[model samples]
Target: MKKTLGIIGGMGPEASEVFYLKLTQATKAEKDQDHLNILLWSHADIPDRTASIEAGKTEELWAIMAKDVQMLKDCGCDYLAVPCNTSHVFQDRFNTMMGGHFISMIDEAAACAKTVGTTIGVLGTDGTRMNDLYGKALRRNGCTCVYPDKEDQEGVMHIIYDQIKKGQRGDLSLFLNICSHMKAKGCDAVILACTELSVLKNNYAELSDPWYLDAMDALVKTCVTTCGGIYQGNL
Candidate 1:
C-alpha cells in the first residue's frame, strides 16, 4: 500500500511546480492509478521563507507550516515533505512538534552530496547560508562544504531572484562561471541547493554537466521511495 504524501509548498511557486513534476517523473508508474497519493498545499500567502528566517521570526513560519500539515493530515496524508531547502532550518523542531512526519530535503541533499564528493560546492539563498542549513549537515557527513565568494554569491542570488523566480532566463554564462570558480577551488561537485536554481537545470543544458547535483532531485527520489513508489530515476 502506498502512503499518502503531502507537500508544504509555495515558498516559491515555480519551484513547487517543478517539485510536483519531478515527483511524477521519478515515480515508475505505467498508469495514472499506479502513482502515489500526493496532496500539495500551495498557499499563495505563505510567508516568505528568506524574510522570516532573516528577521529571526520563525514562529510565524511554524504557525503557517503547522497549519498546512494539519490540513493535509485531515485530508489523509501520511507523510509530509517541504521542497524548499531553507525551510529545513526548522526540521529538528518541526519534526519534534509534528511527530516526525516531515521528510527532510536538507538531509537528503547532504546524503546526495556525500555520494558526489568529499568537497562539495553549494548554491542557495542567504537564509540557508545564515542558518548553515546544508553546510552543517554536509560537515556532519564528513564532506567539506564550499560556498561561492562574495561577488559570485551575489551573482547567484541575482539569477535566483531577478531571473528564475521572475520567469526570466538566467544568464547561462554567469551561472557556469560560478560553477567553474567552485571547481577551480577544488569542489568535486556542486549542489544546486536552491529550488530556483533547480529550475535552471531545465533551461540550461550545461547544468546537467555531471558536476552538478540538484537538491530538489534528491528530495524527489527520497520522497518517492518513502511514499512506497518505485523511483524511476528519470531526473
Candidate 2:
C-alpha cells in the first residue's frame, strides 16, 4: 500500500503545484500504481509568511497555517510536507497544532549539506535570513551556514518576491550574480532556501559549478524516499 502525501500549500500557488509535478516525475515506478499517493490542500487563502514577518502579522499567518494543518490531518494524510522554506519558521508550534508527522525542508537540506562539508551558504527571504533558520539547524549538526548581508538579503528577496512569486522566470543574470557573490564569500555550495528558486533550474545547468542545491529538490527526494523509492533528479 502507498502512503498519501499531504501538502499545505498556496503560499504561492505555482510553487505548490511545482512540487506535485516534480514528485510525480521523480517516482521510479513505471505504472500509475508505482507513484506515491498524494493529497494536497492548496489553500491560497493562507496568509503570506513573508508579509507577516515583515509587517508584524505573524499571529495572522500562524493562525492560518495552524488551521490548515488541522484540515490536512482531518483529511487523513499519513505524512505531511510543507514546500515553503519560510513557513518552517512556525514549524514547532505548527507541528503541535497539526499533530506531528511533518516533513521538514530545513532539516533535510541541512542533512544534505552535512554529508558534503562543514559550511554552506543560504539564500532566501528577509524572514528566513533574520531568523537564520536553516543556518542554525546546519550549525546544530556541525555545519556552518553563511548568509548574505542585509543588502544582499534584500536583493535576493526582491528577486524572489517581485519576480518569481509573481510567476516570472527570475532573471538569470541576477541569480548568477548572487551565486557568484556566494562563491566569492567562500561558500562551497548554495541552497535555494526559498521554494520560489525552483524557477532557476529552467535555465541554469547543474554543472555550472559551485553546486546549486534546491530545497524543493531535497523535499521531493525526501517524499520519494519516505514513500519507498530513490528519486533521480529530473534536472
For TM-score, the strongest prediction is 1
| Model 2 per-residue lDDT tens digits across residues 82-140 | 98899999878766765666778898888887776776999888788777899888998
Tell me how candidate 1 scores on lDDT. 0.86
Which ten residues in a row are the worst by lDDT in model 2? 201-210
Q: Write the per-residue lDDT of candidate 1 for residues 85-204, one digit (tens) a residue.
A: 888887886576557877888888888888767999999998898888888999999999999999999999899989988888688999999988999999989889888998888777
Q: What lDDT would each prediction earn against the true structure?
A: 0.86, 0.80
Predicted model with the maximum lDDT? 1
Candidate 1 error regions (>4 Å): none
Residue 79 in candidate 2 has what lDDT? 80
- Write down the RMSD of candidate 2 (Cα, Å): 2.0
Please provide TM-scores, in order, for all candidate models, with all chains considered together. 0.95, 0.92
The alpha-carbon deviation from the true structure for residue 94 of candidate 2, after best TM-score superposition, in angstroms, is: 3.3
**Residue 106 lDDT (model 1):** 88
